[model samples]
Target chain A: MDDARRGAIEDFLRAASGDPALRITGAALLSGGAIQQNWALDVVLHGAPEAWVLRTDNAATLAVSLPRAAEYALLRAARAADVTVPEPLFLCKDPAIAGAPFFVMRRVAGIAAGHRVVKSATLGGGRDALARALGQELARIHSIKPPRADLGFLGAAPADAGLAFITAQRAALDRQSRPRPALEWGLRHMERTAPSPVPTRLTHNDFRTGNIMVDEAGITAVLDWEFAGWGDPAADLGWLCARCWRFGNVAQEAGGIGPREALYAGYGDVDDARVRWWELGAHIRWATIAIDQAERHISGVETSLELALTGHMVPELELQVLRMVETAHA
Target chain B: MHEPPDAANLLETARALLLAELLPALPEAQKMNARMIANAIAIAARAARDNSTFPTPPEADLIRAGAYDPGTPGHDAAVAMLMDIARARCAVSSPRALDD
Candidate 1:
């Protein structure tokens, strides 16, 4: 952050907090969130040190993501639903303060790296505990239903979440220059065996391990609300159990942290079939996202080798989906 | 025959040098980028060695239209063909994926 912007942010915080002497002690851009930039902030509020995160938009962002204000509303709703999330403080819509709209929230402490989280023996207390905690967190997230004015931006609940996802993925595939037969096969299988329409609830579209903050005791907070929407609650569980999110620890199943039963044990009784269906959807969604990321590079929107490499992940996801369909329990 | 040090071999040699000499000297922040570059080079080398191309299969539209649903005519055959294609792509893009 530049001195001028830092001074502007300090003035904004001072006005918002009603503390004349409030000062920003430190500010540093955090790594991660390809679509968003989070700046770790140290503030002196009321003569005490406060750790907070200022979240703002990146130079390039996916069209599907919610804006900062919408995300702030989501955090409030999730917090009200008893879901563990950072406490949203203030939202600055005026771009002059930081050259872009941003929001401030209390920074929760935990290690969130997917590879390290999956490989660690002690993080999240134990694998089982972490899995259960994740399940419980998801259950809390699902507890939030639609018809909420604050969450009205999510639009009406899908009549059939399965069909909605299938339609979306098909559209995404159609947008690609190359035809993906494997993804098509998976979509066809899903269409043939899609479960009956279920009541839609708030689904964290990206509730995998890496999105959560975890310490030795357990989960400290759930991160990333940009993709939350009214959909099948099982979608969250499926996303958690998706093979790609497991970071190569495929045997564990539940975010590569623990068994499915352990995760389910924390949440209430869940239909296994629905979770399986959404798990397939999760793979399709991930593959689509990878393609989209690569498109950003190919289209000359944002050129980066990371995005280019991500496109190569499509075949592996396709293979996973194919194997799942073939080995699906009768 | 052209030569022993072909494009694929040359790429492999360059990658080996990068890992041996350049990777260790890079800063921590740039290491991941270097590794990704190395991985991209490795993938390119494999692709050059294979010298294969994957055209979109005719079954894509059929599968999208649900002709590949279970018990449908040619469903199994189409699915098998897709699996073969996926495996072949993985061979060049990510061979370890096949093992998994």
Candidate 2:
């Protein structure tokens, strides 16, 4: 950040914190969020050091992501529900502070890298325990239901989550420049077998492994509430079990952490059938998202090798979707 | 006729050199990028050798138009066509993802 921006942020922190003597010791941009930028801020208040993460939007962001203020509210709600999340400290709406709306939250330490977390034998209680903990964490998130005035931005919970998602996917497909036949087939299959509405609950729509922060003990916090909304609880379960999210640890299907039984055990009791159905939904969702990410690269909106390669992942995702559908039919 | 070291063979040689020489010398951060470059080169070499355009078959168009919803005639054929398309894509992108 520039000197002026840092001074503005320090001023905001002083006012928000109600500590006139607060000073920013250091500020550095942290990497990894393609949609949002995270700045690691070191502050000293009355000689006590503190670490905070300032989250703000980049020039271009995913259309589905919630605004930073909305995301702050989500973090607050998630924290209130005893979901492991960084404690949201304050919100900065005035763009003068950082040239964009942002929020500050207490930084939590953990390894959130997908490949490393999945492969590590030492971290997160060696898979089974971590899986169970994740399951329990998801259940707590689902405990927060819709019609919550605070989460009004999420609108009303869809009467049928499956159909609602399929509609959204189809609309996304329509926006694409070219027809994706494999994705279209998957959507059609999903539409044909759309499930009845389960009880609507607050769903962390992106509750896969990569979105979680894991320490040696277990999950320290569930990160990225930008895609959260009211939807079928099973969608989270399916997303966790999706093959694409498994990071090559295909046998340990529960986010490549542990088996489905362990995950279910953590959730207390869940209908396995519904979760399986949403697993199919997860594959379709991922395929569409992969295409969208690729389009961002291809259209010159954003140019990154990662996004370009993500487009290449569609074939595998398509194959998974087809295999799952065939298995369901059989 | 082209030289003995054909395009595919030349790519293979370059990839071998990249992995053998440049990869070890790269920093930890650049290693992943180097590997991705190598993989891209391999895929490109494979595509060159295959020489097929990898077109989406006509049945996919029928499928996209909803001519093969479940229980409809040609649904199985449509599914077969889609599987073929997916398989072809995997052949270029990640052949190991395909079923045995």
Candidate 3:
């Protein structure tokens, strides 16, 4: 913690909750999220010695629309309505807080790893129950109505979010990026048969199995709201079921836990046409991210083994889009 | 108590080719795919072998940290352990992906 940032934390704490003597006791780095860094902060002092988590963007190479303060506000708002989330304390926009901006949320313990709970027969319930719960939670999140002013921040509803996403990806690719035939095909197909009408709502953009914390009993908390924005709720649902998010049970579409029906049931409606369109769109969105990931290797990032494999998923997703498009035509 | 179908065998074979045949032909720079392909093969093999088996303590031991890393592949045993664990978890692959 730098001098200016530490002082900012103190100031924000005092202003938010009217406490001045809060002291930072301990802190340790936690891992897993690719785009950001989270620190397990053990804060203790006068008043309530609250435990907190400090999150900051990890030296980003790509630009994004959401900001830390925005994430903090989203977390705060979500927590108030009983959405399972890390209780946010304060957000620091000051760049001096260990480089990029950071936000503090009260820490809670539960496994956020998909592999951990899904494999544990005791925890996983041997059924698709958890995936159903995730669907329900997502529906609850989409239930919230953000202000009209906030809609612009989100850009647009779910219908064409996929198109906007494809445009962004194609622009990135056209800039001397690596040529991926699979991505091209998926984009063209999506363009040819873009879903009709738009369904917009607040979306937890990265709501996959790994992002949520689960215990033996049920879901403990939802983490990582950085990608949270106003968009199609079903887009997030399809993202939850995207093959890229499925670590093992490729056949089990609901975050690799169960089928789409179970997920749909959890969402409180099985026949919502909006979700199906987003489902195909989600596949295209994932393919775009995957193709760009492959290009990142060419773009000279860390070039990890998994990143390259992730890049290869574009063709697979393109095939999925093609299949869905053909199925739609049929 | 049952083995995965021939599909996993095919996946295992494809994964092997990705690592053994395709990976070796590439330069050090392109070796980023070596560990993932290797881990994918390892997991597919385990998943194929135990697709029908109930969740056992021994089967829960196959996550490979090395496969998760970019530069250094963790020990093969860890990878095997993760692969084994993935057999039970429908998330039988890398739960988290490395940046592409």
Candidate 4:
């Protein structure tokens, strides 16, 4: 952490926690998410303070996450409507408070198994049920209506969001020194017959199995609201069931365990044309993110084995993009 | 029914992925992906052994799921195009598919 940023965060934490004597004792990075940094922060309060999680925008960040303030509002909105989410305790947008924007939220505890949840014995017999539950939760999220102010902040819709995504990605990848035949082909496919125009909605751009917290009962909360925005809701569904997000079980396409039936069944009417369009859009989106990630790795943006692996998924996802496009037209 | 892949053929495919695909990119950090690709290939080989008759990977999913119209004249052509990429990168091979 930058020392100045650290001090600002310290001051913000002291004031936000309502404990002047509270000071950060320990901080360690958590696993699972990379875009928004989750620092397991331990604070000793003067009176009484619980273990709190600090989510901040790292200097090195991905484009997908919602801006900190936006995410805070999103969490507040979801929480009010009975959607389980990390309680948005305080949002600090003042750069004076944190190096960059950050938020303090009630830490939720549970396993969000990216790789094992698909066929886990813990989820025994509950596979279909859990899938249905996830769908319902997503439905609730999609049902939300943001105020004109929030919608304005979220920005205007791209005429062809999918094509816009493809063009942006092409521009970024064209600068790279690599063989990107698969990406090129996928982009062409997306461009040839783009997703049809559809009504955009409040979408959790990263809603998927891996991003959800599940326990014995079922999905507890959806994490990673950074990607939340106003877009095609089908993009969310397609992203959830996308080939890459399924982790180990590609066979279980419905967010790894359930079929699209349960998900769409809950999503209701699913707006097939829109969903198919967004499905194609989501592929382009993921592939673009992947290529950018790969570029990051190759450029030494964030040097980690994991980052390199993320970069490699670009080709695989491009293939999926083609599949989604073909799936749309087929 | 799935056709059983010959053990030797599976091994050969594994070798090719390891050597042609993974080995060349043996930069220190690339091992994770190299291994993942290797593992995915192994699992795919196991699946292949059980059923050598690979379903068209992106087949029926597109048509049935509204990915495209099966009745479209060029649908088969599209499938063939997708298969070419799959055969090259995904290491899927068929004996009797003379056209592909």
> Which one is best on lDDT?
1
Give one digit per residue, the lDDT tens place, for model 4 in A1-330.
566766677787778767888877767677636576787777777865566678877677876556888888888888877777888888888766666777888777777867767767456237777777777888788777544464466777665555566667677656666545445545555566565756556778888877888877777668988777766567788788776677757677677877777777766777665565555556666767766676676788887555655554554555565565556655
Enumerate residue pairs that collide in model 1: none
What does DockQ come to for candidate 1?
0.78
For model 4, the docking class works out as incorrect
Off by over 4 Å in 3: A1-18, A47-49, A124-126, A146-152, A155-169, A272-274, A301-309, A322-330, B1-100
**Runs off by more than 4 Å, candidate 1:** B1-4, B53-56
Error of 4 at B89 (Å): 3.8
**TM-score (0 to 1) for chain A, all models?**
0.98, 0.97, 0.84, 0.84
lDDT of 2: 0.86
Against the true structure, candidate 4 has what lDDT?
0.66
DockQ per model, Cα: 0.78, 0.55, 0.05, 0.06
Candidate closer to the true structure by lDDT (higher is better), 1 or 2: 1
Return the top candidate by DockQ.
1
Itemize residue pairs with steric clashes in candidate 2.
none
List model 1 lDDT by residue over B12-88, tens digit each: 99999999999999999899989999999999999899955655564678778866677878877776777888888
List model 3 lDDT by residue over A1-330, tens digit each: 555666666666566555576666666778635567787777665655677788887665345536777788778777765688878877778776457888888888778777665555455444467777877788888877755453345554544565665576567546534444334444554555555545667888888878888777777788877777766566788778776677666677788767777788888854455566667767766766666666667667756556666655554555555456546655
Q: Please give the lDDT score for candidate 1.
A: 0.90
lDDT leaderboard ranking: 1, 2, 4, 3
TM-scores of all models? 0.96, 0.94, 0.69, 0.71
